[model samples]
Target: MTIAEQYEYWQDVRKGLSRRSVLRAGVFGAAAVAAGPMLLGRPAYADTPGSAVVPFGRHLAFGNDPATQMRVGWQVPSAVANPVLRVGTSPTDLSQTVQAEIRNLRSDYGTGAPLEQYYGHAALDKLSPDTTYYYAVGHEGLEAASGPVNSFTTGPAGSGSGLKPFTFTAMGDQGASAQAALENAQITAQNPVFHLLAGDICYADPNGQGKLTDSYNPAVWDGYLKQIEPVAQSVPWMVATGNHDMEAWYSPNGYGGHAKRLDLPTNGPANCPSVYAFTYGNVAVLSLDANDVSYEIPANKDYSGGAQTSWLERTLADLRAKPTIDFIIVFFHHCAYAVTTSHVSDGGVREKWAPLFDKYNVDLVINGHNHMYERTDPIRGGKPTRTAGVGDTVSPVTDGTTYIVAGGGGASLYSLPSNGPESYAGNVKDASGVAAGYFGAGGKVTEAVDWSRVRYRGHNLLAVDVKPAAPGGTATLTVRGISVEGAKAGTEIDRITITRTASTVDTPAFGSGALLTGAALAAGAGYAGYAAWRKHRSGLDVPAS
Candidate 1:
């Protein structure tokens, strides 16, 4: 249809959609007036006597937290912490009536930038885990809908018996477009128990949806409510940031990603702010800041180098303290290993972060940066292994940690890297970039590659098959990838199953010899992988469908 025809079509659709927030938007007139390249503010509208509670807009809504605690989150007009929270049930389903509310106590989402506290969340304690409950944020008198708009399930109490596999979706770096939105909506349609992201929520290009909704919108957000609504409604959406969702959005220095737009459990480890960790069954999950560490541009610094790194180190240490925690999974926005010929493995990530993971016995590290689906072959120190299939790798006793770069949620496609200096588009480097390489444990970016396999540009999804330890034993963690089209039925191109020994799962036990033994084993096997590598061996190490 012609531009006018399309506009008319959407205009008619908007009539049925909810109206824009009645809140008064910021003054963009002055900024828009003298623009060389115009910058737009969120939808402008006069505050129609707004209520005390932040109104729940379509883009940003709460996700279900899988536990006895409800993860209540909402994107507000500004960074206001005045959202008085409370929970109540619709009379129709008042099976059990229990409610409570709490403020952020200290509500500045990790980014100390001058933000309007775009998102705020509270992990309502004392609720039943695995049980669905109707919840509301803000004041009780205001329109019940004005408060947090949705509800979610708390994490299963503590991993024990009688638990089933819970599903969560993972997507990121989706460039702003109806197609990207539609694909994401499709994945959400799976009705996953939860959804995890590796960052770059929206490419947020110059005319990006992020610009249209302010950074305040992240889910069913924007003009595509139909896409994210169903999934966000039933499942809790979990996330971490990527280069696409840079830490610079609200920055002079750098902003913390602790926005309320994405409903993350503020009750996570550390003063995590935007970064947090939680337990699901036998797994202990750790999500951190990758964007901060990669920011070496003139305008940015390596965020992961300083405080974030310290937090990471401490957090991993803390999770290890938990006894029931069978598997430890770490996720972030940047990929330590890149395969889109356009990008080289983040040697910096290998050198800097690999040691920590090795030391902690972190089973799987999931991230998105390259818009593709690729899994590393049980890496440690940055090296790839020969095989991590069902056999060679132990299922649960001493499985090595695996890393995955899953950045293809539905973003502007990143082409496979042709012969070149590895997707030179945005890798942060100084005159000594390739020379200095990536940082290892001590802020060193040396090329100590000993991690796993990786790919670039494949829009893929992840499926983690977590099987309980052979009853009283350590649990077996299996990870697989699914394409956007075939994801509903669940297809696998690459799969890795790692085993964590009983000793390794128990906290404060200084992870058993599993990490070291497995790493050494995989490292030994990796030599075969190296020999089999395209340039070296007769056969390549590509995954077979």
Candidate 2:
């Protein structure tokens, strides 16, 4: 049967496959009968390899991905021999020839499981953005779910204008290693193009009490693994390191990196493994590291000038040079601006980069050091509203930028600031610094920015979408919070409609840069003359593997 067929069949009898089909399918067929497990889920890697443990307690998220690129992740055993991961375009067939690879990098840092524990990660690249493909990991055909049959899609490069709408999920603090990671992964199974782990991913704290026991181990109870099975099985799961994730260790592996290991897309941002960037439609996303081992400052100072800064400057310059790159977003473990007593806007994010951000005009900033979700309307140099104080009329800051501290991703809950919302922020800075010449140089203050919002508390996920302006229309930015008030329900915490009569063919190719490559890639990539097709909102389907 085709993958779609398998998906359809599973959808039909997925719940009863175990009770009804197990006896009918015989051994291998009985294993296929795991449609129940397929729909419901699995046992953890903690059990002996393939011990009929039924990895349960997990949920499928970000699965059946629909982007041109997709990332599949899941955990297996340290003892499970010849663990080969294979992927393809359907539930029934899994072929490596479909354009995929496998890796078995281990980790010594984590929570829940004991020491010497290892987790598995495989990052698939060069996929057709915005298309769905099925995958699984294991020896060709065994007597069960080698791992799982999941689906995913790469983020769409965009519509006719190389513009695509993308979605990413947020979660944090997987303190229990594979289990916690898995639990969050289960939630991430929603097939987000990627994820935002506010803090404490992998929980591989080499110095922590449980680091040696459970957090670093593979899976003591499979609960989380099963939970995250869906997300890990598909979609790129991005992480923001908290204090707990930075566990130093002596790895027999080359560079002697930290205790934890991540499988990132080597296909992206040449030579930059952990820190990289990608584009989805008009949004350019840059992911960076913020922890000590990542930054390597024993002083444990925050956001010091590091490789990340250099990369950010260069990346932002490149992005600004191209106007087709409508929006800019930066994600790191520590918040550039935070009201949480637990953390604050580090100098690195403030002094070093915020200026460059102002110079380049960054769109939105997302961070997760604090375990809460807060949204800033738009502010330059910390605090909200450029007016320099609260009670300012809400006027969208065209020159300034918006900030979001969305850290709540189902690990643990956090409290509000001691000073409350209005007071949680530092006294407003030079408002005109937000609006070009408004703030005079001589250590002066001018112009006042309006319209900045902030929110804190609750375990939640952020849903962001990138849509183009109407035919000859203006740019609009929309952000939605899927959970708040203790995961109550999704709410529209922030929304803004930006109008700009700026450059339309603002991309480097069409502008002054390599016009030839731009035109050629545009024509060949199926986006040439795409502006005509821009009137419609539906995304153009593309190939992916």
Backbone clash numbers for all candidates listed: 57, 58
- Which candidate has the highest lDDT of all? 1
State every prediction's TM-score relative to the real structure. 0.65, 0.64
lDDT, candidate 1, 1-545, per-residue tens: 22122223223332343333211223233232122111123423224343544444322222233465555554445334234554544423333323322222112223332223234355556666666666555533354444444555556665544556655556666655655655554466455666777676654333221221234332223333335544554566567765445433332223333342445655443433557776777677777765444522112235333666655666665554444566788887667765453333454455456788876667788877666665656754445444453223433213346777777677655654332122111231111112213333344333423233333344567766676643345456666566564333244445556765443232221324222222332334333322222112111232311
The 0-to-1 C-alpha lDDT of every candidate, in the order given, reads 0.48, 0.45
Q: Which stretches of model 2 miss by more than 4 angstroms?
A: 1-71, 95-118, 121-126, 140-147, 158-164, 174-191, 206-225, 250-261, 267-273, 292-305, 381-397, 421-452, 470-472, 484-487, 491-503, 506-545
Q: Candidate 1, after superposition: displacement of residue 350 in Å?
A: 2.0
lDDT of 2 by residue, 491-536 (tens): 4443333323223453433323443333233234333333222212
